[model samples]
Target: MFRPGRLQTAPNVWKRALSNFESRITRHETSSDDKKDLILTILSSTATKREARNYLSKYPLLKENDIYQSHRRILDSDVVSQTSKHDKLINDLLLKHSARSEIQLPEPPQKPEIQLSDTLRVALIRIPTPRRLDPETLRGIALTLRKLVQLGVSPVLVLDGKHQIAAGESRLLTVNDFVHQCDTLIQALQTENLQARTVRGLFEQENFSLPELLVVPLLHGIIPIIFPTTVKKDSTEVVMTPFETLKCLVSNLCGFNEAYRRNNANDLLTVEKIIYLEDLGGIPSLERFQSSHVYINLLQEYDDIISELYIGHLDSSVRDVHVQNLTEMNQLLAIQPAATGLITTPAIATLRHGTRTTNPIIYNILTDRPTISSSLPVNLKKTPQLNTTVIRRGTPLTIHLSDDQPDGKGIDLLEFDRQKVIDLNKLTHLINDSFGKTLDLEHYLNRVNGNIAAIIIAGDYEGGAIVTWESAGGRRVPYLDKFAVLRKLQGIPGIADIVFKSLLLTYSDELLWRSRKNNPVNKWYFDRSTSDYCIPNTCWRLFFSGSRVRTLDDLKGYVDVCSKIEPSFV
Candidate 1:
């Protein structure tokens, strides 16, 4: 069907066109349209399909071709099935026309690489309603569908309305029908494709396998669907998330959800007291809510001085109000349980409720609020007093993890646990001495129960630290949850140093913790730390030891998680 003589005369035509095109360019005497048409004509007359393909590849402007027509003519000739030579020429022409053009085009996409395994990869197609579908959107969706088909992905489409056509042996079903049987869509597709070869053979026998003459109507307000020719298999790896980690996250989210749901009050208080003499103020707004009733009862206990302090005196000047209220409030907060309980009640409650959930939304809600211990007491007794001096020189002090309850030869070292039942009052007293006030005991317990190895207590509980495993960038490492020493025992030579050394030696791995940026103890922490960084606009300074932080991306994940935690110590 390919005439060799007709092709052989192409060189003469190309030479004439080349000379004319060059003359037009040199003289600037021809329009761009005329020059392009002339070059296209010369290229079409090439001596062979190879020459035409090579010529088009080199110039890359003359792109149109009648390769499909040529292919059809060859297959319909007396030499049909023996027309490999003609077929090759038509394929080459088609490839050249499709591959080379004035406009640059990317390479044709290939199907996703998949192993020839027995496992199946599920594909889902979300069907959209036709009432509001646009022509341009339909075209884009069709193109994506074609790509999916080319990749051997036969997605099970969910139809929403009645359909009239039969796509070979494929069946259409209503939304309700599909929804009821939706779980079986993958099995159906796999079964259908598995028998594709047999169905194709039947069609060939019935004389319907050949290309047929049919008019393709313009596609509009319709979804394009593609069926698979054969069953497809793809390889995938599965991973399981830790239950403890998920539980922790959900608890945090639930606490915040409850906080917002229970209280609609703003964070600022109705009344604030500032004292220049003491350089102190009443507890934070959340604390005020927690202790409102307690503070009112305390005012009645000290009723003798109420009139002098203008307690409930509405007509007093703003200056008088500040002078009187500030002094009384400061004195009330100085009392042991009252000040400590006010600050720690909500934190402990929130932590307790937080243990019941691990949702990401709850985690996000919790992080939006300030952590419990971001601020410190303006006044703390510097001269420490010990209730008992039990340790002697060279006393073998061992650090052991507490297993749910305190157990060891020196369990008495943790004085707060002497009551046997670890309750809120004991924890409050413990924190009031160690930190300036009490902390959220429930939140601390949850962290301990979920991820922590144990509570590391020193001899007779002179000092201790909460230790846990935390994941960052998928790598789990040791994290220090809380560290505290009895106020009186602090600054004693070898008291804290031995506990620190023993714990570090025991884990022998990377440890991470955050300290308040301006805390006096940070100087000691920084001296022993391998690395430390102060976060902007926050009071926290993250510290790490035993390993080098790797990439900035890795550091970012660690920072984001740690920064979101409320101050764990008061």
Candidate 2:
């Protein structure tokens, strides 16, 4: 977080510095010394000129809380080609700063983007020990694994032994207990006609090397189960901690390994997902005062969340486990731009989880989306608890609220929109692309001309909102005129959630919007809305949301906007 005393320079002076930094970074004319000065200036929070404003409310007049988030957003949302000079420079610069400051950078070593030659959609699945899982849970896990295989998602299981016992057979309990567990799960998978093989690799000391021939099994459609055991210089195999093994494997798979660097590995394996089946469940939080985070943008929330967990005063063992899960999750996502990770209970991963029919692991692998949106309102969360938390290499969000101006005078959002201050063309592109229809831009302006309230945009227009003021009688309602996310970004975990979160926080008063009765996103709207109505004589369902009770005037305003609003689509 941005601390108050970090930046002593006047805010206006920093503004000039920000302009200079922004202009110079992209220009060939800029000198290296100037860029270094710009980076050092950003080490302070209050003077940050970062564009990732969604999580920070006091943006522009930045607080101390924005530094890590700003740098992370830059890294995670970088759209430049990995092989490009621009991408390399950005990565190098950020890394140099992070290392100089000894800051825990969120990304793993930047790896080459998945190659076109790679044919396998491999997932690294971390499964619980057989001793820990009941028979029913084991069966459920088998079935889920079967489905993944049928869908062409090759599963590489990371089997961990009992935490205390490092090596022995599964007879009673020991370190090598994972061997028995791995065998048991393999047997169950075979019963369902899923081919699985136990894979034990020799890790040379601390340096992580790819197990010789692990890729061969994946190529032939056989599941490879990796044991978390490493060999010392004396050649003795020691069962390392589960995450210890996972860290090594993640590095190898992401091409941060000797094998990959030598062109022997990472040719066939494109790690699509890293599924961690935790018996305890997702990272516990205090959302309503919370456990599962539903979705985590590690780039934005990791440090803050870790700090929260350490201070949460929960059970030490459970907290450690949750923290470790997030630790691996961060590395897993940092593997590549399209990398994804899931941490859910064995029950949620294997059997039915709440109202969802699809397994969380399978669901994420198939669609690259959370089973439930993270941006879902607290009241609408149907699942008893958010058992499954899906994570993705998420995009950054920039939230600009009309009511945030100081001196008691709000910025002219109306003029801003008209002047394309919010990048009207890109916002229009988002609406058009997301809705899959051509927008009558002129007509849209004519309808919401004076009603435009706020426009929230994410990324370079990956998702956005155009809300308006709807009036009836003497009352005005905040109307959600349009909420859209690019189709490509629909599966992204945090995009919709952040968009919805911004809406709720920005409009604390009763906000109203309507959707076609059959619109696919109505459920999202209805879940968050306080009350909803199926407007008579139209194919629209009117929705209202806020803490305030709906009065006759509020109702009138909501109904008028929901029922009378004109469509802006061509």
Candidate 3:
């Protein structure tokens, strides 16, 4: 085998070369990270880079862009640069090692902060076997994984062999051929310090509680790579679809049976994060500023997103993958609402694009939130983070109208009585906590009762929007009386975004809300609203959603009504 880096020698010669190189560098007193980087940087310029790409290139499903792939690929793109750097690094390290080495390695940055919460320590990552293994992308993924293990956030890999079946080659091969090839070649290779045990598939044998085989590897800091292959009744091993494999894991992880409930008797692993790696990247939606949906509140937006994928995009191939991804997420997430579902492409996962310096998966494990906020306007962003989506099950939304009446199948909010559907005590608690002010409950209810248009509540009043109709210029206009989220929940994930989404479902055409000019939440409100203006003589700033606030009369109608509304807070 050709030695990696500047040396094109046999194995024995390569070992000696590494020894001599390390010995020479040891005298320089450089950091371990710097030494490793200088060694890998020089070696990466060798013959093996092409071999790495060629080995995984057989699987056509991987189509990672050259730019987004590991940094090694960047070097490979230009032959002259690779060769020149290789020769120069060898010359400097060997010839100049004694004369105060001229090579200056960049100082290694500090280890990233990994904050593992209750379920953040472990992640069940579903990766389409790392094909098109550009050595650099592999390096980035491996480096990040090692750091996670060091920080106690161990990740288990579920290897999906979809391309083998999707490839036209499956038509010609026998089932035996498929099993042998899929079992052997689909393993995650070429990375340092991470071991992968390919479990032919998840099992439910009468004797085995799914313990012995899987636990040992993990205890030894190995990543257990579960293949999507299962043995059938007749003992013929058949490959399952990626989604089918994940479904079985979810059932066991959620502890469906006594077998699964046991500490180690589970048929599936206890999964905190069910991460899906697809070539299509994140879920898509025409409604978002960017084409990809950054965050999906599955309870409210799942069916609509699924419909969006199916109807508009002519390329059903990509659309079908997106649908399957969300469908799998929605189903698997059914058992564990606390569990998170992340969808992103391999390229996006490995690519450190724009201002992002860390791997997205590693970042997600630490934060439990997407790197980008869902409602952040596209234009305000300094860089584009359009690929990954942070998906979590949302609280079910229920809307109630006043007088228990409907306007032609639509629940009109014109007289929404909070006393009817919403628990008054809980609503009072929510409003008081959100505004940091004590509410005069009697005064608030009396003021909003008859003037209420609709009451929208998200999950036992975790978050809510109170809308009321007001009379101005002899016209009754919808005014956002208060938009209250539990102050504690204000810092939680996607609460405001979900509440606002629910509001639009009920009031599709127009709505108006206001906040004090100095409130920090004004930035959040400004991003979602259609227009805004400061009421000339007052501290309040009125904001409107929908196109109706364009003309002067519309502005007059907004200010005239918003200014007259009475505050129920002390």
Best model number under lDDT = 2
lDDT of 3 by residue, 247-275 (tens): 76666545533343464332223466788
Per-residue lDDT for 1-570 in model 2, tens only?
A: 666665555686889878856653443222233233323323321212221232122111223212223544433443222223223433444464463334222232232121112245677888887778888888888877765654446678887555545344553344345667778888888776666777665466786543433654554456778867776777667767777777777777666333444755334456778888888888776763365777876665688789988885788888888887887788667766577788888887775322225566755654456666666566544635677777766666676654554533333544666776777777778899999999998887777764566778777888888777667667656778889989876644567787887788677666778889999777667778877988889998988777787678667666777777778888
How much lDDT does each candidate structure score? 0.36, 0.65, 0.60
Preferred candidate (lDDT higher): 1 or 2: 2
Residue 28 miss distance in model 1 (angstroms): 99
Judged by whole-model lDDT over C-alpha atoms, candidate 2 comes out at 0.65
Sequence-dependent TM-score of model 3: 0.69
Q: What lDDT score is found at residue 509 in candidate 2?
A: 65
Clashes of each: 13, 18, 8
